[model samples]
Target: MASKIFHPIFFILLIFIPLAPIGHAKRSSPSDKNSSPFNFIKKLKGCQKGNSTKDIHELKAYLEKFGYFSYENNAHAMDDDFDDTLESAIKTYQKNYNIKPSGIVDDETISKTTTPRCGVPDIANSINYMQPRDNNHESSSSNIHTVSHYSFFPRSPKWPSSKTYLTYRFISNVPTYARAPVARAFQKWYSVTQFSFEQVPTNQNSDLVIGFYRRDHRDGFPFDGPGGVLAHSFAPTNGRFHYDAEERWSVGSVPGSYDLETLALHEIGHLLGLEHSRVNEAIMFPTFSAGQVKNLHPDDIQGIRALYNQ
Candidate 1:
């Protein structure tokens, strides 16, 4: 309703969740088996101003994983140093997520980073890190990621045209309030494409199953708890959409709460076979504000249409 405000605490609740890599379950950071990957975010909060620690190195790796920080010899970049470039990248990341650009890794920063999210990254470089386009129209730019319009998947996968209507079911304990928010996301996609979503019974082998999950919920990418990733969906026809049950989810533009509907729009783009945009204003852009109201931007609409030929 009102223009969403950005208080320090306003964004602390919004975590930057990453896309879970689709494959056999992957290994987490080299921590004790009993520890959560999210612990790295918490430990990062302890790094003092103008200092470096093991946790800071891990934080750099985490940011690099999503196309944030990079060095030519990244092999040794994680050797525990909170240098100027790393701090700049961290500040850029904070600014992107609507967090104050404090540059120092504080409890507030780690608090947001600790949440589990979709396995997908905000930047879709070379289509799945190393996978490239057939034509080679795009070249690698600076380490910083930006919107490259009308992007496709690593292999550019999509659903067949004949099968237009996709069945989506709510699995696990999706609350009553969550229904409309989730439905609105589906409606937004439907408006832009020939695709329509049908809600079916849970665990009924539908095309898409929407639900909340906790740590190590089978698909290799484990949930790291409340501050890291928000939700992730599989590439088309796989039909698996999962949200982190641990997040403080809210339906609308509420401070200190995740706008699930906005996230749904982003994840659904991934489901329909689109990649992250280089255009920051596009919905597919990697980072999103916690309290902002967003519709599909013109660039986002263009990207989707380009993929589906709508």
Candidate 2:
């Protein structure tokens, strides 16, 4: 190898010239209120199949992260091309969120994309629980065919029949004030379901556990700071529910702050083995906006009943 030395003039020129960015620009994390991961999606609004841009790569990654992209499209995830797979994924996402499913990134789609939501994948194990389906398998009291949007985790796993009285404990990091809202959330579930719940000591082993975490906390799913993923929970028997500690959580109807009790209610539903629901009114819905509050819908009630054969 040969080594070359720059002249004094070259050094002077280097000082005067501006250097281009080394690689891609630093992307803002979800918690960044000014710019979120979905900002790229906003730039992609009106884009469809055959249109290509560097921003499409980010959109593909977002879809893949939420289980919208298929395995066969993995090779193209990093590419900027918007192909058939990308279009199909968008359509599925549109359908799941009750949009027109035109397969184009439209204003409505972009609006939904920007909202804060749960960390649970809308599609799990290749199953899209958000897809609308008929409730024919279950023995319903009515003869009319009913459309169901609520779903359960794969295999519909639930607490053992012998374990209806489940106990839960809040980890040490959970604040004292947050405990009341969480307890009320459990009471909401107990009001409708046959199962009962009791609180246990944090050190004692309990049927379920709850805590607040920020960023990557060793769990496979990490909290996305203040604005992105608000919380996530594991499926039945593996009762782990977590909240993003960085979020502005409130028990009252405060603007710009997420109601802790509302989110806790949703996570508790997931703790009971329910997956994301297509019904926007249901607590199992994947997305939740700040300052919004919701209770269990009929779909949620029917889902829990069907899962436990209550």
Candidate 3:
């Protein structure tokens, strides 16, 4: 949306270009110092101590997406110099993710940002209309637009018990390995809620639809091809879960591999209508690692149970 200097981040390929292919199949971590976007960012300067650059704009957009920055000023945040707002946002992001609160966009911070995360906003306030919007939910505080804790979109939506015995269908065309974690992800949520998910073939209509897509696959929020976002799901009753087919998705704890199960678990929370959590230990937390395995945190359980009356 701007010049080459101000194009959205990720447009820059590393000068050395040792990073893996960009796709949901994988999102590199800081450990991949030799080839990650973080490594590229770490080599730069002027992104700290109230100094900004074009990269800072990208970072600002990222922070807004994950709930660190406000949605109010999202339209005009393209400053080439870092400001107090960016510093504070970086600190909050670091604190939530357990990074040292340095207020700098260091290698670790950029690496984590590049990690696969749900394409959904940390909290919605009528900004993303890719799916249905509910405006009935009240705000916890007027000052804060979005918080990191497990929250509800507008009205704290939930599936009724009549729909408890839900059915889902995986995009039949993807590799079989994708099925393992997708199925397990549904079961994981089933263990805690009144809901029980059954898989139906794509030919038949299902309550939930799961599939892989790449770039602007027509649901409004487009996948940026590789590292920036992993997958996204619409809020409950909407029942749409989409993964970036471009990602190098893995089924298990493969180092340097993006865990489909971990991501599926997080996205399912969204399908069930739960928001991102402030608790770093919570499955609903906004950020995750390449090989992370997380069970439902109390906050996650409470949020879902509260919505479902379980």
Question: Per-residue lDDT tens digits of candidate 1, residues 1-310?
Answer: 2222221111122233332222233423223222545565666665644785766778777877666667777654767877777887777666655578888777667755654445676445423322223542332457744433556676678998776777777865775566666777888887777777767667677787887787789986666655567677777878777877765567677654567788888888888887665455667765454455567887677666667777
Error of 1 at 173 (Å): 1.9
- Write one digit per residue (lDDT tens) for candidate 3, span 181-245: 77777777887877777777779998999888877888888887555577888887899998877
Please list the C-alpha lDDT of all candidates, in the order they appear. 0.65, 0.78, 0.67
Tens digits of per-residue lDDT for model 2, 1-310? 1222211111111121112111232323335465444566778878999998768888887888789965564668778898988899999999999999999999999999888898889888877878855542343556866566788888888998777788889899887667777887888888788777888889999999999887799988776555678889999889999988777676745556677778998999999988888888889898887668899888888888889888
- Candidate 3 accuracy as TM-score: 0.73
The true-versus-predicted C-alpha distance at residue 275 of model 2, in Å, is 0.9
Report the alpha-carbon TM-score of model 1 versus the true structure. 0.65
Model 2 is weakest, by summed lDDT over 10 consecutive residues, at 5-14
Q: After superposition, how far is residue 30 of candidate 1 from its true place, in Å?
A: 30
Per-candidate clashes come to 27, 0, 20
Error of 2 at 270 (Å): 0.9
